[model samples]
Each structure stands twice: as C-alpha cells, then as structure tokens.
Target: MRHVDELADRARALLTPGSRRVLGIAGPPGAGKSTLAAAVVDALGGQAALVLMDGFHLADAELRRLGRADRKGAPDTFDAYGYGALLARLRAPRHGETVYAPSFERELEQPLAGALPVPPDVPLVVTEGNYLLLDEEPWSSAVRPLLDEVWWVAVDDTVRVERLVARHVRFGRTEAEARAWVLRSDEANARRAAPGRDRADVVVDLDSGRVTPSAAPA
Candidate 1:
C-alpha cells in the first residue's frame, strides 16, 4: 500500500521547466478518480491545475434532445472530440494564453463552459474521468495521445457500488432509485470502461492503498 503523498510525489516528478504535462486518472464508476486527481493537484499547489472531462458532459437539454439522458455518464454522452481538443491545447499551449475549460455542475446536471482557466505556465494539468483510457474511436484514437500518463484507479467493487448508490441518493434519487441506477446504469458503464485499464500506465489500487501497476515502482 502506498500513501497518496507518494502518489503526489510521482505526479510532481512529471513536471519540468517550460513544458506542460497532463496526468489522467481513469477508472470505473465510484472508483474515486476525482478525489485523487484533486488531491494531487492540490498537493502541487500553483504548479498544477484541474480540468475535468466531466466538463464535456452533454447538457441535460442536449442529452434529452439526443435521447441519451437515461445514460448520462456513458461515453457517448460527452463531447469526446472537444475534450481531445482541450487536452491537445493543454499539451501544447500557445504562448501566454490562458486556456479556459468547462466544469460540470452535478447538482444541476449540466456543464458550465469556460469555468476553469488554466494558465500556460502551469506545469501539470491533472484531469480525471471514466473515459480517458477508453479505446473507442474518439476517446482512444484522439484523446489518449494527449495525456502524458493515465492511471487506472481500482477499488473494492462493493465499496464502489455503495458509494455510487449513496451519491445518487444524496443527489436526489430515492434509496431504491439510487440502487437501481447504480446497478443498471453505473455498472453497465463500468463494464464498458474496465477494458481500458489495460491501456493505463499504472493502476492505483485503493483497496490496498497501493500504486500497483504491473510495472509501477515498488
């Protein structure tokens, strides 16, 4: 098991003078990708910034218009191409340009545009989401190349599902409704994303509290 500080130090190692690095955290639903990404970014302070892939989530109106509101977190519900473009810009920013990225408003279930301003000088841009390592047409072919490294977060499935249910309840689903959605929607999405773990540079096992990618540091 490894402490998050150890992970923070590893993230810090990616930083270098006059270059931008993007760290990606990818995992199944409720695997704590956001928490880890935020912690690492926080640990780095001014040297890093956070730009979430959830920010590319299709607006509720747009999702409903596209008839995909029922599967909100599924890969297709996001602007995959746009997210790739944003990452590419973060990877190679124009001089002195402060790039603005979108943010997701969970309570409102919508994405807010131009919500995060990432400066060109920030050495690390830490982004987290489920689909970063997804080897689909747009995500794998387009998005994967933009990231310097992607870590797959692994957790006890029972704990992960419980977190998903509780989160759904807290966000307005009834207890029964929450469990149903977690099992039906989140689980399905997890299956779709699980294969991407093979594409990750490392695996962060929260159950063991260790960074245990096949070739990761011991």
Candidate 2:
C-alpha cells in the first residue's frame, strides 16, 4: 500500500539518461508484488515495461511429467534458468528490436509464449516474482546481478493467506481446495522466500502503505 508517487519516484531514479534499468519486485505469494509492480509501471507510463517470472512457469505437461503439478507454484516448478537467461537478454537488449517475454494465463493455467513485448526504447523494466532475491545457485548468479534494485513486499501473514485463498477460489478452486492449496503449497513457498526480505534494498509494508530501507532481519 505504499503511495504510488513514492514508488514512481524510486522507479524513475532507476532510469539512466540513455540506458535501460531493471527494477525487480520480490515477495512471496499473496504479498501483492504484481499489484505494486503494475502500479509502478502505470505511474511511469511508456518509460517502463513489465516481465513476470511467472511467465517462465513450466508448461503443465512438463510439470505433470515431472510429477510436480501438485506443487505447481513452488520454485522448482518454474524454468528458473530460462528466466535468468531472459533477464540477461533484457539487461542488454538489441537496438530497435522488441524483446518478447512469455506470460502466464490464469484461466488456462499455462504459460503463453511471447505474450509480452518489451520495446527497445523502454528505459525501465519492472519484473516481479517470489524468487528474485533467492541466494540459490543459478538464480543468485543469473538474476541478482542484472537488477538495478529490488524491493520486497511484505504483508501480514493472516491477510496474505486470506488474499491467497480468495485468489485461488476466484481462479476456479473450491473454497476448501483454495484454503488447502494456500496452506499446503503457498505457505511453504512463503517460508522459503522469507529470507529474501533481508536482502532487499527496500521493504514495502503493504498493510501500512509505507516503504523503508531494509535493515537487519526481523
């Protein structure tokens, strides 16, 4: 819930006079990372673009083949290396060419190829996902170095979980199934991602609508 103007100002700072900058929004499920990222992009107007790590979700067939469909939102369920590679490419985009990125379709529950376009002239690319600040190999090595800055979104656990359950239900899960998924899958991912808050340049308190520089882990 941080003020949109403050977020826009931070994003604008990432813009160099003539070069591109990448600002990453990292947080666990239900933390409103996408909402915050979209707001910053909208505030920045045409100068910014968005690329979602969820876009790198492995196709359902691949997930089912790997026996990971049940835990579909887990870090391992995504094409982490591929996402990293795309970040690398976006970091050094070619002149005058649009860089296409995949997008996740909620209704279809699948990744759609080349669903988002990052035009060359865009000065800021805002990417959001749960794992951007993860220290794990390939991810830390491939992703962290490319980001100009990363902000961590934080919300109260009860509120986050409630929001997550409602999201799942809205997307076609039974209420019971939604609650089960949040407890079994999303909560586990949240725990795994908690450590990343300490690594962020800024920690956004969504419930309070405040943004502050990160300090020692709480």
Candidate 3:
C-alpha cells in the first residue's frame, strides 16, 4: 500500500493562509476515498475536517418514491446545487462561522445532516466523494472552482473490487450479495468515474500509494 502519510503531508502543504483550501478526493466506489479522507483528517489533527459528497445522496425512501432506489449513487440522485452552494460558502468563510454538513449512513441509507462541522479556524477542509471530478452539468462546474487542489485516488480494478466486496460485507451484505452488488452497481459507477481521473490536479495511485501531477481536461 502506498504510504498515506505522504499524501496527507502534501495536502497539508497545499493549504493557503486564511479560510479552507478545499482538497477534494475523488474516485470510484471502493477506491478508498472515505477511508483516505478520514486518514487525512486524523493525520492533520485540528487542521482539517471532512465533508463527504455521499452526504448529498438522496435518501432511499426519496429514491424509492422517485422509483430510482435501484439506481442509487447515480448522479441524478443527489442535490448538486446544494453541494455547490456549500462549497461556495466554505471558500469565503467568516470568523466564528461554523458550517454544518451532512454525512451518509449506510445502514439507514440516507443523509444525516449536521454530522460534519467545519469551524472557522480549520485551515484545511477535505471533501471526498465519487463525483467531485465529474464533468457533467451543474456537478462538473460546481466544485472545481472552489478547490485549492484536487486529488483523484486510483487503484487497480481487482483491488478495488476486493475492497468493495469487503466494504459491502462489513456494512451488512452477505458475501454473494456483496460480490453481486459490486459487479452490478459499483462497476457502473467506476466506469463513469474513469474520465474524472484525467481532470485531477494530482492523480494518486492508492493501490501503490503514489502521487503524480496530472493534466486537466482541455
């Protein structure tokens, strides 16, 4: 595994004085974006906080009501405009301002509001999710402008599948169910995630744990 400490160190270095330097960690499902985001905040102590894009996911009931529950994690299932506005707020942070953000609960399959809070003093805000680099309407133009740097976590497809299976199992799926879900749903998201890698400011080989400068899409 690539040493996570190096990534955290580099992310810390990218922070500018005053307000948060939104560092986005984008990748497909099971690529370790959430785990890596937690690690970054853990490594940085008080200097960082986490804002997950998963928090923007529409609730399962809402999805079901819309007849899109089976298509969860698809781009249309989120509040893209709301997320964009939140990023804009983070960019021009005020003293004593504390912004509350939502977090996803796998068991509940919904977003829990106020789960993550960003205080005025935190210099770095690490926001991780699958679609941060997505180049589609609203979402594509939403986040990139507010970010100081963007890093995409890349891993081998095999390792990613394994991680996804383990994650599903950990979150309460049976072994067979986990594998099926990974193949059926997660892979679709992964394929959609591929193009975003090219748009990343830094491409991180999470499997090997190496970071390389990458060109943005023309």
Candidate achieving the largest TM-score: 2
Ranking by TM-score: 2, 1, 3
Using lDDT as the measure, the top candidate is: 2
TM-score of each: 0.95, 0.96, 0.93
Quote the lDDT for 195 in model 3. 90
Displacement of the residue 162 alpha carbon in candidate 1, Å: 0.7
**lDDT (CA) per prediction:** 0.89, 0.91, 0.85
lDDT of 3 by residue, 10-102 (tens): 987977776468899999988888888898889999999899899999888889999988768888888888898898888778988899989
Candidate 2 lDDT, 1-218, residue by residue in tens: 44989989988987898788999999999999999999999999999999999999999899999999999888889888899899889888789899999988988889999999999989899999999998887678888888989999999999999999999899999999999999999999999889999999999998888899877542
Q: In candidate 3, which residue ranges exceed 4 Å CA deviation?
A: none
List candidate 2 stretches off by more than 4 Å.
216-218
Model 2 accuracy (lDDT, Cα): 0.91
Local lDDT at 6 for model 1:
90
Query: What local lDDT does model 2 show for residue 177?
Result: 97
Write the residue-wise lDDT of candidate 1 on 1-218 in tens digits.
34778988889888888788999999999999989988888888999999999999988889899999998899999999999899988898788899999998878878999999999789999999999888788898779888888999999999999999999888898999999999999999999999988888889998888786556322
Separate clash counts for every candidate:
0, 1, 1
In model 3, the clashing pairs are 2-209
